[model samples]
Target: MKSRSVIHVTGAMNMGGTERMLMTLLRMKPPWKSIFLTYGTGTGTFDQEIKDLDGEIRTIPNPGSLSDHFQLFRTVKPAAVHAHTLFQSGIPLAAARAAGVPIRIAHAHTTADPSDKKGRFIYEKLMRASIALSATDYRACSSAAGNYLFAGKSFEVMPNLFDPKQFKRPPEAEVLRLKLKYGWTDKLVLGSVGRLTKVKNHAFMLDMLSELHKQGIKAVLLVVGDGDQLKTLRRKAEELSVAELVTFTGAVEDPSIYYHLMDVFLMPSLFEGLGIAALEAQASLTPVLGSEALQPEADLGGGLLYKLPLEAGSAIWAEKAISVATDSHKGTSDPVAVPPEEVLKHYYQLYRWKGGGHEQKTADYII
Candidate 1:
């Protein structure tokens, strides 16, 4: 019997949340083979890993013409096309419809885009219309993301699944090595993880560090991940005279290991479809202090998750951080138990569904 396959259309498979979720799916070795169709002709952080897992990676032009996508779909002949590029998903989904793919999915991963300009509104409207017409299924990481993208349309909320075992505390020697390497010994370590992008609100973390300094707290911040805002954030740290108290560790493949090094995890994102890092931190039993902008679903029933408004400013945020980190009960409560197989089963069920009937079950193509 021939094996079935699915194609996943997304931006560069970099270290972002969406990409990481896709990688998790691939690593799980689902029932079908996985193919990744990236938006441009460049490599991503996960490209090599995908290949090692017997998955394939192909590229289409950036904003590829409809005909280009249509032709690619025809050639690859996938059973499904799962598009993860937000409104841009409409184009490929339409092409998949034209190519007669059976399981066309539009997966929404964000609630908003700060960079969208007024002129792009028309484009979004048209693409959304196209998505409505073409997609056979709609899914999102959270209700907020689903409502934002599919508005009036019903969609499934697919939790971003991760291997909780990866988050277990590392050996004492390894923990000490990391602390020594980053000069974190004898300092209160507040950590944040994600790309150094504006929407992530990393600058607010710097302000919180500064506030902690003002209060005579020997606190230091460790920001993990890399992005365009690195230089800007470094400059902000210098301007605030908090440079010595902040350390920016560029992208790390296994950020879960670093979670053990933090006394408290901070997330001040302006918006999130679902905050995966916050979830990961909680999985590591690290208390999370997030902005109110994050969806409540991010809490994962963990007592360690705390939220406050960004309007309360860094002073209050710093105080909360200290309070949460210093509480003796911190790290005592485990995150809500989520069996990894149960999470993988959701994707398996989604992939196997085809609007009804066993006839479509054999046509296992995905994108």
Candidate 2:
């Protein structure tokens, strides 16, 4: 019998949440021969995981050009094309539909920029465009993501579940502290793992840290991931007098070490479809504290969620964070019991066992 093939087209293999979630999904499903598409290159990228599973990896660029889509469609010839984020979803969807593939599903894992009425309109328009172009079905990490990504479109919920075994727990305090140059004594370790970009809202986290400092609290912030906003966020830390307390580790593929070192995980995102990093922190068994509900799904059985304003004005967000710090118990730190690998397995079983031919209206969903 011929084996079924699945292709996952994503931004890159730069170790972002969406990319990592794809990796975990590939790892959990040994039966599925997965293929990866990246816009950029990474050495030893998903090196072992993909190789060990005998999965294939490919690279291509969209450049917002027409030829890119044609090239992507012809290359893989997959039974299904699973685009990891909105930015790259339509390209593959158009390609797959043109190629007459059975399924072209898009997954929305990142929070979008929706500040003004016009901005929201554009967002809606983009959602509609993608829906009209190539997507067959829609999958969201949370219901919020579904509403945001495919308001008029239809979608299914397949929460981003994380596998705990992928994370290597740091030894109790001593080793990790010495490595990170942080003292293990009285400081509370508050960390967040994600790209230092506007969407992840590192700025908001910095403001929250500044707030913690003013309250005579000695908390340390460790961040894992890098992006365009890294420099600005670092400067903000200095301006807020929290520079000495913040450690930006750049981007590391495996965040379990960082997760192991943290006493508490922090997600100060302005908006989130679903916070996978929070799930990772939960897998690490460290508690999470955030200023807003990243997603109703992230708020599920674990983690603490607080209300936060979208101003990004620093002071307002800082003030909002204090209440969370004072009443820390209001946040759940033990992490949720759900396993991400299991969730992926369930999705595979539900979809593959049922055997659908195409996603249909799913493409026209969020656009």
Candidate 3:
């Protein structure tokens, strides 16, 4: 039997939440092959992993360019094209429609605009309209994401699933060793994992750290992941006079080690689809402090997740972070579980149905 081809479009096959979730799905070795179309240089932290899974990754120099999209769609001739993008999905969706691809899935992964680039809002408005006309199905990581892109239109909430076991708290000795290796000894360690982008609101984290310092709280912050905002964030930390207390450990393959060393996790995003890093923090038995703009569903009903409004300022966030770090009973041993296989099965079934192929029985699967 000839396997169906499913093409995945994204900013880049990097360590971001969307890319990581797609990589998890690829691990199942499903019936159909996976092809990735990235707007970046095509090289990322997951490049080797995708290649190891026999998945193909191609780069498009100019993403959201109609010509490039049309050409790629024509070349792939895939049965289905699954685009995991933010607001700018219209180009690929239109191209997929033009190529006569049976299934065109526009998967929205964010509820907030991560960039302040000029013409972003206007472009998103146009793209949103185009997506409505071209996409056959809409998918999002959360209700917030769906509502942001599809609004009242029907869409599925596709949870970003991962191996829950990998996130569990490691041995105390191991955690201590990691902290020692990173020179973070005898300090209240606050951590965050995500691209150092403006929408992520990392600069606010620096301000919060400065607040903690003012309160005479001895703490250190470890940031995981890298992006255009790294330099800006570093400069901000210096200006805030908290440079020595902050550590930016550019993107890493596994965040489990870092999560283990954190006394509390922080996410001060301006907006979010679902905070995967917060979820991972909870799994590691670390408390999370998030901003009000984040979707409430990110809490996953765990008592450890705390949300504060951005207007509340970094001082309030710092106070809460201090409290959470000191509270011993806050961490949960049983974190919200996301069985990777179950998520993969649902996606596979969705792809099959969209491709006009035989659908699999998956009545038990839940969003």
The estimated TM-scores of all candidates read 0.93, 0.80, 0.92
Per-model lDDT: 0.85, 0.67, 0.80
- Candidate 1 deviant stretches above 4 angstroms: 1-3, 353-367
Model 3, position 38: C-alpha lDDT score: 81
Q: Better model by lDDT, 2 or 3?
A: 3
In model 3, which range of ten residues has the least summed lDDT? 358-367
Error of 2 at 115 (Å): 10
Rank ordering of all candidates by TM-score, starting from the highest: 1, 3, 2
Best-to-worst lDDT order:
1, 3, 2
In the range 1-367, model 3's lDDT, one tens digit per residue, is 3226889987787677777777777886776778988875546888888888999887888885888888887887887888877666788889889988777899988886666699888887888888899998888888988998886889998767777778777788998888788787889898898777787888888998999898898889999998889999888899989999999999887777888888888899888888777777777777888987677667755668887888998888898898887776674445566667667656766775332233555523211
Every candidate's CA RMSD: 2.9, 5.3, 3.5
| Backbone clashes in model 1, listed as residue pairs | 6-366, 7-366, 7-367, 8-367, 79-365, 80-365, 82-367
Which candidate ranks first by TM-score, i.e. highest? 1
Better of 1 and 2 by TM-score: 1
Candidate 1 residue lDDT tens string, 303-336? 8888999999999999999899888876565688
